[model samples]
Target: MRKTRAVLVSAAVVLGATLTIGATPAHAETLAGVFREHSECERVGTRGTDQGWWDDYSCEWEGRYRYYFLYA
Candidate 1:
């Protein structure tokens, strides 16, 4: 009975770890979405002459300029 309990506990721990790891990507995607939504480009303008445009134009995370993490 003691061995069975230990095995169950170990299995639970492994499952919890797997779930935590799996959740990390989802959390990252959410965070990236929030970032993009709040980014200067979207809040300001794409054109260089627009107010706050310099910040957006210079940003690397702008959707139009970004190549990596496409889903994000």
Candidate 2:
């Protein structure tokens, strides 16, 4: 009876650990420190920064919030 109880307790502990590890969520990827293409429409600038492909031209605009990535 003691041996059976020990085996049951060990199984419960292993199962609990496995479930806890598997229940965690995975991390997500972010877009930072990458080249992008910029374009200005009206007074708002739109940019596409995915991977390292920059093919864009900018025109003069007023009261626009523009963002760009810098490499050092």
Candidate 3:
């Protein structure tokens, strides 16, 4: 009887651990906006950085610009 109880307890513990490890939270990717002008893009990038997000900016021509924010 003692041996059976020990085996059951061990099985329960292993099952609990497996369930906990298998359950993982999902993260969603967010894309902010395509801000035109250099200053606008810079502001977006700065905001992203301040919010603990990875920031990237791109420019096309003189006034066209865009910023991308990524979260890990």
| Among all candidates shown, the one with the greatest lDDT | 3
- List TM-score per model, in order: 0.38, 0.37, 0.39
Residues 1-72 of candidate 2: C-alpha lDDT, one tens digit per residue: 999999999999999999998885543233324233332231222343232333342333233434443221
User: Which is the better candidate, 1 or 3, if ranked by lDDT?
Assistant: 3
Cα lDDT, model 1, residue 3: 100
- How do the residues 5-67 of candidate 1 rate in per-residue lDDT, one tens digit apiece? 999999999999998877755333211222344355343334443553233223235568453
- Give the TM-score (vs. native) of candidate 1: 0.38
Worst lDDT 10-window in candidate 2: 36-45
Q: Give lDDT: candidate 2, residue 27.
A: 38
Q: List the residue pairs that clash in candidate 1.
A: none
RMSD of 3: 8.4
Clashes of each: 0, 0, 0
